[model samples]
Target: MGADTITRTNRVTALAPWLLVLPATMAVFALLAVPVGSTLAESFSNPLGVFENYRRFFASDYNRMVVLRSFWIAFATTAIALAAGFFAAYLIAGSGPRTKRILILLSVFPLLTGVVVRSFGWMVILGRNGILNNALIELGLINAPLSLLFNQGAVLVGMVYLFLPLMILSLVGVLETIDQDLYSAAESLGSSPFGVFRQVTFPLALPGMVVGSILVFTGSLATFVTPRLLGGERQMTLATLLHEKAIISFDWEAANTIATIMIVLTALSLVALGMLAKRLSPKGRA
Candidate 1:
C-alpha cells in the first residue's frame, strides 16, 4: 500500500472507537434528564401552584439552620482533613519505598470500617463515660466526665476520620511526582526544610490539596449516614432534613427544596475554590 494511504487507514482506525461512544453519551443524558426534570418541576410547583414552596424555604428559620449547619460541618471537615492529610502525604512521600508502601496501606485504614460501624465505634469512644473520658480521668486531666457525643464535635471527628484517606491518597499521588531535587536545591541555596516546603513544594502540591478538599467537602455535605447516626436529634444537617422530609415527614416539597439548596451551595463552593486555586497558582495569570 502507498504510505499516504496506510497513514490515512491508521488514522481512521484510531478515530473509529470514539465515534462509537454515541449511545453511552445518550444514556448519560437520559439518566440526567429525569432528576433534572423532576427538580425543575418541584422547584416551580406548590400545593395550589403558588410560590409557597420557595417562600417557605426562604422564610423558615429551621430550614435555614439546616443548610447552615451542613455547610459549616462540610467546610470544617474539609479544612481539617486537608491540613492533616498534606502532612501525612509529605511524610509518606519523603519515606523509603517500604515505608511508603506501609503508609499507603495505612491510608486504607478508614475504608476497612463501614460508616455505621465507625459511628458505633465513635459512640463507644465518645460517650459520656467513654474511653477518652476514662483515660483523661485516670491521668487527672479532667475533674469530671465530658459530654462528647451527639453534637458538632463528634460529627467533625467522625467526618475527618472517615474521609481523610481520600485526601491523603490524592496528595500522595501528586507529591510522589514532585522533584525532590528541588528540595535539595533549595536547601543547598540556604533554605530550611520548612522554607522549601512553604516556598516550593506546597504551591506545586496545592492543586491536589484543593481537589481532595473539594471531594471531602462535597461528600460531607451530601452525607446522610454519619451525621444521622452521630450528630443525632439536635444536629439537623440539610441531608438529615432532606431524609426526614422526604421519607419520614413525607413532605416531598420541602425535601426537594432542601436538595436543590444543597446542589446550589456545592456548585458555589466548587466555583469559589476554583477561583481561589487559580489566584494562588503560579502558572495562573491573575
Candidate 2:
C-alpha cells in the first residue's frame, strides 16, 4: 500500500475500539454525568451562600445524628455480611459439584425476591402480634407481646438480608478460582486446616472480600425501602431524610446537598476499602 493509504488504515485501527464504545460512553454521559452535574449545581445554588446548605446540614444535631447513624448501620451491615458470606462461600467452594450447585442456588434465591417484599416479610415476623410474637406468646415466654419492629436492629436485619447475597456471590467466584491443591499442600506441610485458610485461602480471597464489602456497604448506605420500612420515623437514616426533603418537603437544595454528601461518602468508603484490601493482599505484605 501507498504511505497515505497505510496511514489511513493505521488511524482506523487506532480509533476502532473508541468508535465501538462511543455509544456506551454517550449513554453514560447523558444518563449519569448530566444528572450528577445538575444535582451538584443545584446543591450549591442556595441563596444564603455557596456553602449554606452544607453548613445547615452540619449545624443541626439531628442531621449529624442521622449521618452518623447511617454510617454505623452501613458498617455493621457490611461487617456481618462479609463474615457470614466468607463462611458460606468457603463451604460452597469446598463442596462437591451437586452440593455446590444447590448451595449457590440457595444463596442466590433471596435476590430474586423484591426488596419491598422482603422488608414486608420482616415486618410480619417482627411486628407486635406477628409470627414471632404469637409463637412466643403461645409458648408462654412473656405476659404480653414484645415490640420488635420499627427499630435500628430491625433495619440492620433487613439490610443484612438484602445485601448478604452479593457478598456470598463475590466471594464464591474468587474462592472457586483458588486451587484445591493449595489446601492439600498446606496439609502436607503439617499446617492445620485453619492455618491453611489464614495463610493461603484468606490472603487469596481478599480481593473478593473487598468487592463484596464495597457492594454491601454502599448498598446499605443508599438503601431506602428496607430502612424506611423497618426503621420507621423514630430511626431516621440519611436515605429516608433525603426522600423526605425531596418528595415530601419539596426542598430541592437540601435534597441535592444530601445526595452530594452521599456520593462523597460512598466514594470515600470505596477508597478506604481499596487501601485496606491492598494492605491485606499477599503482594502488599511481601
Candidate 3:
C-alpha cells in the first residue's frame, strides 16, 4: 500500500503541469486550430482540382503583382521600423526613469486608439489641402499641393506608423535587459562609442530585432484597414485583394486561397528569421 501510494503521488506530480494547461490547450484547439483547419480545408476544396485555386491565383498577373507588392511593402516597413525603433528604444533605455516612463507612455498612446481612427488621421494630413500640404505651401516648398494620398508611399507611411510602437516596445524590453557593465568594460578597454555599440550592443540586441521584424512584417502583411484607406484601389496589396475576393466578389475559394498563401508566407518568414537569428547570435559567432 505504501509503495502504491508513492507511485500514485509521483504520477500525479508528473501530470500536474499537463492538467493545469489543459484548459488553455482546449481553448486553442477550439478557437485557433479549428478555424485554421477549416480555412485550409476549404482552400483545398475545388471542383476542378486541389491545386486549381492556387494555380489560378499565381497565373493571374494582377494577383502576382499584388503578392509582390505586399512582400515589398512588408519588407520596407520592417526595415524602416527596425531602424527607427532601435534608435528610439536605445534612447529610451538610456534615459532617466521618469523620462523613460513618459516616453514609453507616449509610444503606447497611439496603440490605444483604433486603426481606423489612425488611418483617417493620416488621410486628413495627406490630403491635397491637408495640414501637411498647407504647411508646405506656406513654406513655399512647392507651387501647389503635392499628391500624397492614395499611393504606395502613403501605405508605407501608415504601415510604419502603425507597427513602429510594437517594434520599439520589443526592442526596449531587450535593450533594458542588457548589462550596463558590458558598456563600462568596453569603454575601459578603450573601445569607441560606435565600436562598443557594434561589438556589444548590436549583437545582444539582435534577438529583439528579430522579434520586432517578425511582428512588423507579419502585421504589415496581414493589415487591411491602413492599406485600404491609404493605398486606395490603385495600390492594392494581398490583404486588400483578399478583402475584395471575400467581401466584394463573394469568391470563397479565391479568398481561402489567398488566406492560405498568407499563412504560408508568414510561417516561412518566421522560420527564415529564426534561422537568421541563430546565425547572428553571439554563441553562433564563437
Candidate number of the best TM-score: 2
For model 2, where is the 10-residue window of minimal lDDT? 277-286
Put down candidate 3 lDDT per residue, 198-230, tens digits, no spaces: 999999888888888989999899999999999
Model 3 poorest 10 in a row by lDDT: 277-286
Q: Tell me how far the alpha carbon of residue 1 in candidate 2 is from the true structure, in angstroms, after superposition.
A: 17
Estimate, for each residue in 1-286, the C-alpha lDDT of model 2 and write its tens digit: 8999999999999999999999999999999999998998888888899999999989999999999999999999999999899889989988999999999999888899899998999999999978999999999998799989888999999999999999999999999999989889999999998899899888888888889999999999999999899999988888999999999999887899999999999999988988898888868841
The TM-scores of all predictions, comma-separated, are 0.85, 0.90, 0.89
RMSD values for the candidates in order, in angstroms, are: 4.8, 2.9, 3.3
lDDT of each: 0.86, 0.92, 0.93
Clash list (residue pairs), candidate 3: none
Model 1 stretches astray by more than 4 angstroms: 1-27, 30-32, 47-51, 134-145
Worst 10 residues of 1 by lDDT: 43-52
How does residue 277 of candidate 2 score in lDDT? 84
lDDT of 3: 0.93
Winner by lDDT between candidate 3 and candidate 2: 3
Cα RMSD, model 3: 3.3
Which of 1 and 3 is ahead in lDDT? Answer: 3
Clashing pairs in 2: none
